[model samples]
Target chain A: MSDQEILRTTGLTMRFGGVTAVNNVNFSIDHEGELRCLLGPNGAGKSTFFKCLTGQLVPTEGTITFMGEPIAGMDTHEIVNLGIGIKTQVPNLFNGLSAYDNVRLAAKRKHLKRQAIEKTFDMLSNCGIENLKGSEVGLLSHGQRQLIELAMVLAAEPTLVLLDEPAAGMTGEERDRLAFLVKEVTKTASVIVVEHDMAFIKQIAKNVTVFHRGEIFAEDDVKKIMKNKSVQEIYLGKSADAA
Target chain B: MEKSILKDPGLYVMVSIGLLIMIFLPIMMDMFAIMQITQYVVLSVYALSLAYIWGYGGILSFGQSCFFGLGAYTFAVASINMGSTSLPFILAIIIPALFGVLLGYFMFYGRLSDVYLGVVTLVVTLIFWKLINHTAGPQYAIGDARLGGFNGIPSIPILNMPTANGQMMDPIQMFVTFMAILIMVYVGLRLLIASEFGRVSISIRENEVRSSLLGYDVRRHKVVVFSIGCGIAGMSGAMWATYQTFIDPNAFSLEMSAKALVWVMAGGVGTLAGPIIAVVILQWISLKLGQLNIINNFVLLGLILVPLVLILPKGLLPTVKQWSQDLWTIWKKNKANEGDTIIKESETVNAGRRK
Candidate 1:
């Protein structure tokens, strides 16, 4: 492990009885304030790999080291408290609570009461949803809810941030806003995004890791990967080459 | 963030009004009415215990009465042996709280949740009920306080002033103590709900996985909430014991547990005021039913509850609050539209004058 490396996983494998969702894979991020994108086709083990890192799903075989500590099977809260922030694929917010409360609770977890309030409002305004603070998260549109969850994730002040399918249901405007926020987050913390939208990735990603069939298929600069024959073949279903 | 309760003068003013009523209640009512109301007030405290855990924490423990009975039994036995009220009174809350810690550790730490958690608590209450019932033998006596089994302990010491040889409270004074404590519990719970602990507990209830991923120890928060409920229920149970001067194994019965649930569900699952109102109304109906003998208290309760569940799924208070809010919005819209029409009418008249 290098001094700047924030996380490293060795032989990371996840199996569901007969199915190995994530095969033995070694991965790492070796710089502060880095932004990495994970791209893949469906069933490519991107989400499974993300889950392994967050402790949402323990690996059948692997060792995960983060910030110079072994945290493979630690509780999710423990991992989060160690300065890793996570946002699940779908927005799982407190539906009954106001948007302010949802962000405030997350902010409150890391900061003192006054600072938490300040941070909450600051994050809300950053996400451009300060006007919707009083509205219930459950009643908000998909884009609005996605932005709120991103605000919540940023409120924790994590040194490492993980986001899963952040642009899944977002409009073009919402996607650009999310991309801007992800870039801003990368200015202070290393961010790893798992996304299916290549256009969304192009806006912010410089380095990318492609997953295929439960393994890391390729790791390179996003520009090189975009033009690579195999990578394009994998994405366009192999017939784009013949056509 | 919820503004601290201390900043809310309205709550203080409301409680002050409740205090005034407390002072006047005994003077205005007969002893029989006072006694019944006192019991209802104590039961309200017990109901609040469940409301906090179920409504906010989203832990629906069906065995709340087991802790209530534990508190009652603890008070009875401790007061009998000690021949004083002070130590027993404190123990009434602490013992049940300790039990809560133990039980909560198992349920929350073991990752029991939702229906499974509910069933575990229900089974626990039954275990206590059966265990207490079997202790009819003289061997069941701990020191001087008898287990009394199905008969329960009788002539337990009344609540008293803190002294070496305590002076027992008169009926009116006892009534005041019970009423004051109920108000205090209500205030304390409100403040707690506004605090970090309360908000986090609500978050855990909302989405445990999300809360954990955001860096909260969901299990620990849950255990603290459960224990707090136990302590509150225990305190109320002790007061109930003091009022009756007796307690029996029936305190742990399934009926007692169900009654608290019905009260919380019918009154309002989330608000403290709802359960108190529900308890008073339902208990009053129950008293009336006892006199008429037309229907069993529970039968009438079930009849009322089914509709309450069907019509107002959020419970009575929250539903009523929503209705008022909806009505207010409609009124505001109407007022705004009326002003718009008046402005449009004036503009049309000006245009006609110009023509």
Candidate 2:
């Protein structure tokens, strides 16, 4: 609701039959370029919450507002048109198409014809994926494919980017490059990364939201979150009785 | 943008040669052969309607004949009522397009796709077939034109020049008109596929979820493409009606729908020219088989088709294209004294989904 806020969610919740995937929660991110990380164990509701934001899933109860517009339960295209870039957990790409074409389409959507051509090449190079431009994405390695999707999402020049486990299947060197590319994106857009890699999180994230039992158990500076006793206990799979 | 479609030297040459052949071949053939080619031209348009929707939009319907039959019936009834041949063509195109919009809205908007989409289309065509079959009574008349059920509507008006005082097209004039129409439809589709919207449609076919997340209205695009294809089918149906001077429920038959799928698959699914050429070749084969009478026409056609599909799973045209590309690459490598680099380039040419 505030001018500084790019996105805000009020009492957001998602339930599947008997189980609550994302419990009631209120969350917001600033309009300023910032890299925020969502960290949680396997089923701590981070991905569900991300899906709700991307309009891939309609929450059982909640309201998601982006840039003064209500986007919760809106069509995926409608949500995307509101200046949000979305990437699912896996690489969702046009596998049959060349990588150049994949980025070209995204760039074309957000710019004029001439500018689109320029931006497509620029984004491809910026993401360090210019080499794979002519290759079919389906045949590319997992890390390379992830970077291509990153280039595509960045090509649109969105105000907010929601990436789910972008470095899920990457080597250490690839993760380092991904971290660099993601930081470059944060210079222009607000990025929310849902990831499990603490080392990767330490590299790019400033603010980290640690989710536990379908709720945000801890929210702090990345350095502080790494050392907090309670957060450590939750992350280590230690119960209160054992502690 | 469409004008630039024929700008490619290779494609431009091929299209010009193909058109010239169509124009000249009728001169050498007898009236019977000319009329048969006209029939194939009309069917080419129908097959193209399927090619556009399924090949590009990735929405395969087993009941494209529903639109084809609607156009035929619309032209028949409207021409008979108006007592003029010219205006009914437009109605033929518009009615089926309107129906496409209606049906596409239900299927795409409701997300009823894939196998369900195929079944829904199949059921729709069958419903049309059943509905038209039951219109045997005089009460089924639309104004002056009666639905004669299985017997069909005869004495239908033939096509006339739009502003030539109702002068009907003769055999030669009709042949020329049909050829021109076929060429325009083919070029227009090529233009459409080369545009930004067309590229986006291809991307949607590759991955619907990704296209949507990338800010494309997947359902709306599919609906529009489906409707455009329906309109083309209607135009071809009108052409068929004019040629036969009869309209029947058989226009909506399952066999009519299946032929479109077969022609597209047999020739090639992705190329615009593939389905059109396949329709003509297969129709000719069926005609030849009918004359020989050594085997059932459909069965013999199937016997040939099965082996063709087995040998080249990607379809006739695409495999031929890949083979040509490979040959060209090998020649280039030999001439330039390059080996590994040319081989990689050749693989890129052969395997890349879109040219």
Candidate 3:
């Protein structure tokens, strides 16, 4: 919970062919044990920015530093080893493996065999799918599979976690459970959730960053961000008019 | 120890069948048949190398014969110069392994896609085949062994007992030796697959990006697995040289590579026993068909493989495993239903008696 910067990106930009997906975005996160939700419309470049931070995409023009070390050209595995966990837009668990195995594999990187097994069970339990540990991840429902993927990220015990659209296909009850889980995770690790669902964001977000057209449109507390005119114009649209 | 082996029915079945063949086959078959079986055993080892890479490591190597040919050549050259079997055997394994590491470094580190990797390996095999075919002159001689080109280098020394100097192995001894080596290789690969390294490799096969994000160096793992597979292929090549007592450029031909792929596909990828069984069955069928004058052996093999491939896309062993699992689940469900019916009947009887 210390006020030390865990991640910083200076003028981060990603270009694919002639299109600039993420343009000159300067962002930093200093809240070590707090949840930060990123709100953006489709093609607003939040996913692209997340990819750059997680080393899935190297920024064409920007410098990304994690804990004051340059991580722009580092490999994804190397970035993970540096204690950053990422869950992509799609649930990326190994479908053939059991839920326990998915978490155990990630835990194996940071723990001994015996400890990893124990930690995997704990993670699955925390995610409220301990009963599904023996079930193959592929057989689980979308929400259950998403939970397993989150448990895998938690098993790694990362200092920073980046989640992309974690509750995309969840039921309302599942989304509420996910919101609680994200809030709980922030107590131990810094969490940045990129979500489009304003309801889900409202449940967990204390600090919010609204992205528009590959740039940061607004950065403020949830209450203030909801009232921001530009964020309302781009995101809420008709809903804002009714309000 | 006994309980663990008994837990795995497939292992138990494979071992019992292998032991029965080793013990009884020699008594039942003639010397010529035993010799042919030994050749098949050698080829089974070659097929295993492909299965390990293709099935387990998710690497499709279309030019695996490059390592096999290199191993045979190294064995022939070293045996002729050193006039000893021991050093030549070691050289056969080491030379191919080193070559695999070198080639694998470029392919893996350069981030070549799977198709490109196959193409590069196939081209490398062709290069070796063409390069060795032209070495037909006196200048191509190494020590007392002359590079005979298409005719091949003949009268190559067979594997000898390490303790007994100048003592060549008899056909029976070679047969037993190769079978023992094959068994050891199978066990070793099984142990490897059960290890942490094996789990990581399987994860890599399932999803490379997920494995990488979990802090696994995907490229390094690929290279290491590819090299090990190449080394195994080389060992098989060394055995082939010893069995035939000749080494040739045709060892590096595309035909050898294609045959290996067929053996793996027919047997099953991913499982060690599958490829071994496939190679033995195919070799036996090919030999039997060779006696016939009407059909070519290659065409006969094609006929057998086409149906199997079309019917069972996952190959023999995996399909069998899946079917068995399905049957077991059905049986378990039937048993549970029977138990529920009995309970209901008892409850009805109790109510009638009370009334």
Candidate 4:
């Protein structure tokens, strides 16, 4: 696909109980079929920014345009309909529902016919979580739940996916698998990943936006953002070994 | 422990026996008494309605009695005025469904949460009961069929099958008439739940947030399910009017609503069979208690409900399914143990022959 701006936000700001969590941040990402990482230290407003973009919260002052249509006032459901999907840091699968049913719920939104269900079954196979189909999401291991969540978002056939700490609670092998899955999703949809893991970021992110305080400290390729002195101080801290 | 006998076929045979009893029940009893049984069957309609919304749509409408009352009163008044019972009967069911649509619009679009929705329905039911009870008087007559208000509309003509000479039919004919309506309503309900709309209702109950994210108009689904559930309840109400030939504000009181809720909760919220099994079992017990001349009906209700809750919190059907599965596993384990013993005995005999 040709590069284009699928989602754009201007002057995005969020305040909760008089504390400014996210300041006016002007940001846009062009559809480059590549993973873009939003990196920040603790309390850098990374998650807040993602939430605003995904319509989970109405920004105090900002206009979010998705696919060239204003979506700031849209509800979370409407935003999902507008082709933006989100995978939360926590495995937000319905505990009582089987893994297949969880993904089937999302898939039904796209095409709920019998053929569509078969297609969803295929997607599950691709994610290597097909055997867990009959298992309740609550019963699944952490790594397995992540796979189910990915399958669910994919089932919606979203044009853009906002992954908040997709590999937050995973072993090295699990994180690598998640990195591979994120890269694979890029072939079909633009992926925005918010993560602090340097190795995972380097593995998937083609472009990186480094956040500090409540603003973007740097936006560039992985190598430049990783070596930036301010980025090092904010994320890696003063110790050289932190790098 | 033969595996074939432990299979689903045996379970299906049990269900068939239940169905046979249901079909033959009225024939064995006096038709006048059967008409009384029809009242409970009508209540089953309301219970099933509650099941669809509370069990499938995840709405515990404490005001379901409101729709039941609305339908009963509408039919009673219309039948009295028009001097035609059928017209009022049809109107009764339709009006309540429309009422449900309007109520659903406000409750759902207002973004009212579950607990508030229950309160709103409860408040509405109480308000209607109070209004109707206070106003019912002797002068409240529609074409000579008196709307007794608190005394209730009484002696409304039981529907008669008219012949060419305008011959009026008897009570047995009325029972047959209501039975037809009951069967049709029951089948309609089954088909409705099997449709795409039914699936959406179940989905909403499972997860409203997820359903919305999947692009379903959650408010629309809620309204539709609410209307359908209320409509079924209204049909039952119409049936009640036909059988009793009398309806008062008491018919729509909080007590009735509470009983219906108890029935649905004890039966199982999500399962279709829950309400049916609950109705037959609970109503049978209530009937037997009534025979003993018990003034404390509430005590009888508590006796059945408390045990159902304590033993089968997930509802009767889920509990039964779990127990059956456990039994099958135990049987299979015993059979495997016996097979192992026989195999070891055969091997020892072969060793003796070799020696």
Runs of candidate 3 exceeding 4 Å displacement: A17-19, A210-218, A223-229, A234-236, A239-243, B1-9, B141-146, B323-355
- Provide candidate 4's TM-score on chain A: 0.93
Residue B166, model 4: lDDT of: 30
lDDT by residue for model 3 (A1-243), tens: 678789999999999999989999988888698689898889999999988988878899989999889999788889999989998888888998888888988888889989988998889888888889889899888888888889999999999999999998888887888898898898889999998777787888899998888999889999898888878887977664453
In candidate 2, residue B308 scores what lDDT? 86
Candidate 2 achieves a global lDDT of 0.87
Task: For residue B106, give model 1's deviation from the true position in Å.
Answer: 1.6
lDDT of 3 by residue, B200-241 (tens): 788898998889889899889999999999999999999999
* Candidate with the greatest lDDT versus the true structure: 1
Consecutive 10-residue window with the lowest summed lDDT within model 4 chain A: A234-243
Query: lDDT tens digits, residues A1-243, model 1?
Result: 134789999999999999999998999988888899998888999988988888888899989999889999888889999999888888889998899999998888889999999999999999889999999999999888988999999999998999988988888888888899899998789999998787888889999999999999999998888888899877646533342
Residue pairs in candidate 2 whose N, alpha carbon or C atoms collide under 3 angstroms? none
Alpha-carbon TM-score of each model against the true structure = 0.89, 0.90, 0.90, 0.85
Tens digits of per-residue lDDT, candidate 2, B18-132, equal 6895789778989888888889989988998999999988989899999999999999999999989878999999999999999999999888889999999999999999999
Over 4 Å off in model 2, which ranges? A1-3, A15-20, A212-218, A221-243, B1-4, B333-355
lDDT of 4 by residue, B196-257 (tens): 77777777777676566666788888998899888888877876776677888887899889
Q: How many residue pairs clash in each candidate?
A: 0, 0, 0, 2
When 1 and 4 are scored with lDDT, the better candidate is: 1
Candidate 1 versus the native: TM-score? 0.89
Better of 1 and 4 by DockQ: 1
